[model samples]
Target chain A: MRATVIHAPFDVRLEELPDPRIEGPGDAVVKVVASCICGSDLWPYRGDPPVKQPRPIGHEFVGIVQEVGFDVRTVKPGDFVVAPFVVSDGTCPHCLAGYQTACQNLVGYGQGKADGGQGEYVKLPYADGTLVATPEVPDDALVPSLLTLSDVMGTGWHAARSARVKAGDTVVVVGDGAVGLCGVLAASRMGAERVVALSRHEPRQKLAKEFGATDIISERGDAAKDAVLELTKGVGADAVLECVGTAQSMTTAFDVARPGATVGFVGVPHGVEVPISTMFRNNIGLAGGAAPCRAYLPALMADVLSGAIDPGKVFDSELPLADVAEGYAAMHERRAIKVLLRP
Target chain B: MRATVIHAPFDVRLEELPDPRIEGPGDAVVKVVASCICGSDLWPYRGDPPVKQPRPIGHEFVGIVQEVGFDVRTVKPGDFVVAPFVVSDGTCPHCLAGYQTACQNLVGYGQGKADGGQGEYVKLPYADGTLVATPEVPDDALVPSLLTLSDVMGTGWHAARSARVKAGDTVVVVGDGAVGLCGVLAASRMGAERVVALSRHEPRQKLAKEFGATDIISERGDAAKDAVLELTKGVGADAVLECVGTAQSMTTAFDVARPGATVGFVGVPHGVEVPISTMFRNNIGLAGGAAPCRAYLPALMADVLSGAIDPGKVFDSELPLADVAEGYAAMHERRAIKVLLRP
Candidate 1:
């Protein structure tokens, strides 16, 4: 089998690797049909997070099951499925509460020593809970959309749920990345009357508009807050989805929220300092973290299967597995919203 | 009128001041029977805040109505009442939502030209919303308990409500000052089965036990978190009330709380960096601030009126108005649980 591996900074290579086998009784091997580069993947590629050993590079994918271990019951060979980034037992208290990302015995796919979805074949643990099967094999075009259910889509759903987004809400999404764009779509699907996207890129902003953004604010700082405030008639947004993990983005989300509104932060907080005083005084609720991807994938897959939301639109560029390095480079330079890879 | 005034750090004086009058349509004048020193008062008195002018001191009080403006309707002259620290309009949007402390026209009782309860007579604005009437005027012994209802008791109630304390909850309260001690009472009243108080002061810890603290952790750092976790069988606390407004206190509160719990913080946050990443990852909810004093005073007053709870037990020191400076000094030096001054 062939897989993408990172040797060092800005160096990605598709090399021959041994085919993954089912090591645990609950594990299953999947022949990858499609995989995609994720924003989080850039972390190790940019030399930001030290990578002493060559590591598996992706987590988002849709594939066909090739083999299953003895204890696996829900999934079998020939089954088409989406594998969430995090693997959970599906029976833990946290997993039962729909927070599988925080499951006590959770396994992080991409960061673990275990092989991830970026390869021609990958090993998925806790197959019954980590993989959601589609009723039928999706078409070539629908593969991209189905592949997104593995991560970005589920994360966007988590953002909406954390914010308690509901009908008639004026939601403000902070970020123009794939997750941010999906957040706009999720907010709209959740019945938000208005969705505002804050972006600088022309193409991403246009895609955001198509994905249900009723307003766009290209400005940053006080100007951005003023734009959202003005759009919501000075009361600020009813729900703010912070998709960028920076102090400036979190502050903007807090500043643009109404007194009783909620700020859902799904962005992995990079260097953020949340002002506890401001949040307390305004009674604003802050909720969100790593999306319980496994918990939300089933429903998100149903939505995608029913064609209610086109989350696949986030894949602005598609390439063969051999060009995986370009995908990482493009995402690092903010040139691609998301890159889909055919295995 | 004779009142306590702080001219500078450690420079409190009992000086002659003009008697308060009904200056507005919604105003009332009360002849203060008792007033007390609060921990927050030390912020300015300790020279942490800029002081360009002599400031009237004290915000908590219980008194007898001496005069009322033309529009005052809730109470009449000669009626005994408890004045909440915050004076709100009561009809604003925020007030209607049970957040009167953030009322559009909210006013803090003292610290500027605003006269405080330390005077013989104090002016009360928005009296219809600020003062809670008692069933009858009680003897001098009941004065201390009733006075606490004005701020400390009500503040603790706000903390409990913010933390969403419920029956049988395992609660932890950080800070053993009057507010934290009162929080023990409040959480107990709210039906918590296990109440833990984090304090190093033996006297305060003893008072906390008397006020319904089932456990106490005197150690700081990892030991405190370990103590709380050990008490909860490694699950941590269901609810935590942060009553001290400092970075260290806030960190301890967060560290001691379990996943999916709420950390209610009524402390005026000072130099606290709210770590949102940990909060989101741990699924902890943050609620509380400034204690919507007026909103909870009515219920606390009822407890005092019916003798259901003796909030006045927190007043460990009492002095005449002539010794008002000593009262402030006692609280500033942490020598008093709470200081009561007779006008």
Candidate 2:
């Protein structure tokens, strides 16, 4: 099978790798129908020193089960399914509490005996607990939407939920990436009365509105904070979704929240140190981590299936599996909001 | 009027100062009935650079309103009241949302036209919002309990509430000082099934149990963490109340929380920086600030008036106004859990 592999920084290749097998009794071999490059993938692709061993790339996918190990019970061959980026036993205390990402026996994809979700065929462990099967094969048009349930959409939901978004809330989304756009959708769907999307890019700003942004701020840093504060009548927003994990973005999220408001962040954090005293004095509530995507898959899948949401619109480009390198380039060059790959 | 003054580090003196009077439409002059030396007083009294002007000390007290500016409507002369350490306008959005401490027009006690609560008379700003009136004059025996309602007890309640303590939660109070003992009481009152108090002080450990600590751990730092983990079947506590503002206490609070648990902290933070990425990944929630004591005042007052709780036990020593310096010394030397002063 050909899969996306990173040999080093800025070097992505579609390499011929040995096909995956169901070695674990709870594993299933999936024939991936669609996969998408993620923002995190760009971390290694854009000049971070790579590991000595080639790394498998991508974790978001929608696929059909080609085969399952003898003990796999919940899902079987010929079923269309979506696997959350992280696999959990779904029986541990944390998983039972709907924080599957923190499950004691959690296994992240693209590692261990499993191949990347971007591959033509991949082995998914804990098949019974990790895979969510659709009632039947989804319409080809809904494949992109289903693929998002694997991570980004679930993450967006996590951000909104963590912030405790309620009806009549004024929400602020701090980034305009695909995840940020999805946050706008999630906040709106969660009944936020007003959602302010921050963006300087005209294209993303337009898409942001389509995804339920009631307002848009083009400035960055202090100026952006001023705009949000002004729009909120100086009270600040009731909920803030931090989709970018930089210190600047985190600070803005904290600054733009009402005294008792919460900032729900799902961005992969890096080098962010929060001054606890400031948060304490301001009465700001900070909640969110890696989204327990598995916990939310059931509900979000229903929304996608019923056409209540169209998060797939964020996929602005699509390419064949062999052209996977170009897919990364398109996102890296800002030529695509998100790239979908057909295997 | 006599008041405790900090002329220099370790130089607490009972000084003769001009009596306070109502100076604004929103002001009231309160004749203090009882005031307690707080842990925070030691900050300025122990080696902090002194100002040219002597600083009036203390922010915790129960008092009687002696006079009010014409516009002060909530309480009149002869009303016994408890003032939150911070005064707020009460009409701001933050105050309406139960975060009075972060009110847009926040005026901390002891500043502006007001003197500290420790003085014989204090000119309080935002009188209606800052002072909570008791049904009548509280009994002399209840003076210490009522005084605690002004700050420490209210702060402990804030910590328990911020952590979202539920009926079945196992709570850990991470300090054994007066405030920490109060937190154990708050958590237990909030219905935590098991309350753990961490302290190495034998006397404090005894008081912690009387205040509702089901378990007491005499270990500090890592050893304390191991004990808490062992007690919780290695899952850590569901809610942790951080009553000490030091880095060591703050870190211990985080270390003993279960995944998806919350840490409620109320001590005035001195040098605490939180590792956001680690908190993000762990799904730990951090909440609580300067207590918003005014918000919790009414409910807590009812609990005290009905004799349902007795936080006055923390005031193990008492001093006359002239011995104010000795009161500070007793607390600094740990010879008293809390020192009550009468002017």
Candidate 3:
């Protein structure tokens, strides 16, 4: 099997690796049907110091079970499924409570013993808990959308769900990346009356609109807040979905939210400290984290199979698994909102 | 008129002052019938610099209106009412949305201009909005209970309401002060099946039990959290109310809350910065701010009038306004759960 590995900064390469096999009683070996690069993956590709040594990369994937361990019962060989970015025991208290990200018995792929999902064959732990089977093998065209269920789309959905986006809500999405675009879609699906996307890029703005943005604000920070206030007739938005984790983005989310409104943030936060005084004065509610993608996958996958939504429009580029390097470069250079890889 | 003044640290005195008179069209002068010192008022009494000198003190009061400005319509002369700690216009967007604390035209009393509540007479701003008229003036025995409505009890209610404490939910309160006792009461009223009160003091623990604490923990920090985990069979409580503003209190709130639980905090926060990464990973929801007490006033007053609840039991000590210094000392020295001041 060929796998993508980031050996150093900007050094992504396709390296041949031995095929994976089921090791634990609860594990299964999956033949990767499709996989994709993620925003966080760029951390190492862009030289984040913590990711030091060469390692198989990519956490999001849609695959078919080729073999299952003796103890596996929920899924079987030939079953097409979506694997969330994190593997969690379905029976844990946190998992049962719909917070799989905090499940005590949790594991991450592309780590140590687990085979990276970008490869042709990946070993999946807690297969019954991490994988959600589709109604049947989805069509090739539907694969892209189903694969997003592994991370980005569900990540975006978590932001909206956390903010409690309700019918007739005026929601603000404060980013234009794939996650933010998906927020527009999620807010729309949640019955929000108006969805505003903040973006300065022309192409991204168009994509945001396509994903269900009722309005687009090209301005950033204070100006973006002003636009939101004006759009809501001086009454700030009902919910602010922060898909960008920067300090400025979080600030904008608070600034544009009406008093008593919630600001749901799902981006990997950096240098963000919630101004306690501000949150206190406004009765603002803040929720969202590394999305419990496994918790949201079942519903989102159903939406995809029934053709109720089109989250796959985010994938603007595609390549065979061998050209994984090009996929990384395209995403890093902002040439594609998302890159789909065929294994 | 006599008013309680904190001229300096340990310099509380009963000072003679002119009787308050309406100064604005939205103001009304009230002859204070009952007043009390809040836990926060002790900050300056103990030498916290932000609370400055030579000012009339106390923001919690229940009074009888003496006169109303020409523009005041909702409240009139001769009405017995309760004033929220913060004054807000009843017509603002935030006020209309039940977030009076964040109203655009907000005003705070007890500092300057607005005559302090712990006085013979207080010049109330936004009289129509800030003051809630009871069905009728009550007997002396109920005065202390109604006075609690002005701040501490309302603050506790805010914590429970913010945490969304519901039927059969297990609620943990972090702080055993007046507000924490009030939280136990509020949670019980909100239908919580069990309430855990954290307090080391025997008197406060007794008060907590009276207010409906199903359990009590004398431990603080990690041990307290361990007690809570042990109580809940390691699943954590459904809601955790943080009534202590210390960093440790906030941390304990998170440490003892279930993954999907909310931490409703009402204590004046100091040095409490929520670790966003931890909150995110646990999908922990953080809500609560200055208790929108005015928004809660009507419902609470209705309950108070109907005898459905009595929040006044938190006032355990009584002192004449002239002995305000001793009142502050009693609270500071942990000799009293709360001090009631008579003007």
| Cα lDDT listed for each candidate | 0.85, 0.87, 0.88
* Predicted candidate 3 versus true structure: per-residue lDDT over B53-87, tens digit per residue: 48888899988989998999888888899888888
Looking at candidate 1 chain B, the ten consecutive residues that score lowest on lDDT are: B108-117
- What TM-score number comes out for model 2? 0.97
Q: For model 1, what fraction of the real interface contacts is kept? A: 0.38
Backbone clash count for every predicted candidate, in the order shown = 0, 0, 1
User: In lDDT terms, how accurate is model 2?
Assistant: 0.87
Which tens-of-lDDT digit does each residue in A191-297 have in candidate 3?
99999999998988998888889999999878998898899889899999999898999999999999899999899888898877788878899988889988888
lDDT by residue (B1-343, candidate 2, tens digit) is 9887788888888888888877889898889898888898888888654545677878888788999988988999999999888778888888988889888888765565568767788887889878999999988998889889888898888889988998989999998888899999999998999999999999999999998899999889999999999998877888999999888998999999887888888877878877576678778888888788888889888988898889888899998878988998898999999999998
lDDT (C-alpha) at residue B181 in model 1: 94
User: Which should have the higher lDDT, number 1 or number 3?
Assistant: 3
